[model samples]
Target: MEIIIGPLILVAQVALNLFWWALVISAILSWLVAFNVINTSNQFVNSVGSFLYSITEPALRPIRRFVPPLGGLDMSFIVLLLIILFVQNVLARLQYSIG
Candidate 1:
């Protein structure tokens, strides 16, 4: 029982770390999308952008609702990235504090 619980906790922590990393990449890609660095109108770009949007949009939507665009620049991506960073730090601390 003790061995199982210890391994499970380690697995959970690793999963959280990977998720935070994914958020970081997603945020960078979102910036690219916003800047028109990779035009989504192109067929290949559109497909990839659509897939990324499906993954990240749910996380971005609430931030989008509360944080409006400023100076024609969307700030939600930054906000989302900051939130993910906060969450990752908190989880890392929790992992240390636990074991």
Candidate 2:
């Protein structure tokens, strides 16, 4: 049981780290789109944007509901990233305590 649980925790940590990168990528993509630096009509750009949206939207939507954007600058992404970091820290502490 210890062996199995240890590997599971490591996998979870990796997953959270990957998710953190995804959120960062999504935020940057959004900025590019907003600034018209990337053309959404292009198939590749559109597809990538869609993929990012699908991945990040589920987590961000709820946050958006309660915290509306201020002056057209959305802070929800930042807030979500911070939340993910906090969760990652807690998970790390749990793994340390267990081991």
Candidate 3:
């Protein structure tokens, strides 16, 4: 059990870390696009933006449904990040115990 569960927990922790960064990048990219700091007309910028949207939007949509944006600010991103952080911490504790 320890052999299998330990590796699985590690993988989950790594995935969560990647997801946490993805959310942060997506939020910053959205801001840049909104402010015209980065134009979607540029092929590279558009491609990255689209890719980020595709990946992050699914996770965010449900959160948005419940929380809704407040005063032109989206709190869903923050909420999602917090949830991810909590999960990561839980994984860490689990991994510690298993190992």
Candidate 4:
């Protein structure tokens, strides 16, 4: 049981880290799109944008409902990122205890 649980915990940590990076990439891509730094008309850009959106939108949608945008700035992404960070920290502690 301990052997199985240890691998599972490690996998979870890696997944959480990947998710955190996905959120960061999504945010940066959004900024680039907004500023016209990247053209979505290009196939590569469009595909990358779509992929990032699909990956991050599910987690961000719920946060958007409770937290309204301030002025013209959308803070939902930031809020979601913080929440992810908190969860990652908790997971890290759990992993340490288990090991």
Candidate 5:
């Protein structure tokens, strides 16, 4: 069990880390666009923004349902970040225990 579960947990942790970065990037990109600091009209900018939205939106949508945005400030992404962190920590602990 340890042989299989250990690697699985590690993979899960890595996946969570990648996802956390993606969410952070998506939020920052959105802010840049909102502030007019970055022009989405550029092909690369538009493509990146669209890709980020497509990947992150599914994870964010359910969280948005309950938390919503507060005073026009969206906290869903932050909430998701917290959840991802929690899961990653748990996975690390489990991996350690198994190893």
Candidate 6:
């Protein structure tokens, strides 16, 4: 039981780390989409954007609220990424302490 539970927790932590990384990548892609480098009207782009938004929005919405758009540029994503990194480091340390 202990062995199984331990690995499960590790896997969960890794999944969260990967999710944060994915959010960063998706955020970058979103900027491209906004700039029309990637066709936002395309089905593929829409699907990808929707998926990323679902995962990242909960964390990002608050940041977005406080930081309004500036000169047509959105800095909320970068702020969200910073927060994610902070959380990731904290979680890593927490896992270390647990082990």
Structural similarity to truth (TM-score) of each candidate:
0.66, 0.92, 0.96, 0.92, 0.97, 0.71
lDDT of each: 0.73, 0.88, 0.91, 0.87, 0.92, 0.79
Model 2 weakest 10-residue run by lDDT: 1-10
The digit string of per-residue lDDT tens for model 2 on 1-99 reads 767877888898898889889899988988999999998999998998899889889999999998999999888898998998898898888788888
Off by over 4 Å in 5: none
RMSD from true fold, candidate 2:
1.1
Error of 3 at 88 (Å): 0.5
Candidate 6 lDDT over residue span 4-93, tens digit each: 655766787788788878787787887798778999789988898898888888877889889998998778877876776787677677
Model 5: per-residue lDDT, tens digit, 1-99? 778888888788888988999999999999999999999999999999999999999999999999978899999999999999899888888877776
The deviation in Å at residue 82 for candidate 3 is 0.3
* Model 2 TM-score on a 0 to 1 scale: 0.92
Q: Which ranges in model 2 have alpha carbons more than 4 Å from their true place?
A: none
Candidate 1: tens digits of C-alpha lDDT, residues 1-98: 55565566677667656656666676677678888787767898777667767777887788989999999777887787677668767766766666
In model 4, state the lDDT of residue 89.
85
Root-mean-square deviation of Cα positions for candidate 1 versus the true structure, in angstroms = 3.2
Local distance difference test, candidate 4: 0.87
How big is the positional error of residue 83 in model 4, measured in Å on the Cα after superposition? 1.4
Which TM-score value belongs to model 1? Answer: 0.66
In candidate 1, residue 70 scores what lDDT?
100
Candidate 6 residue pairs in clash (backbone atoms < 3 Å): none
Please report the candidate that would top lDDT against the real structure: 5
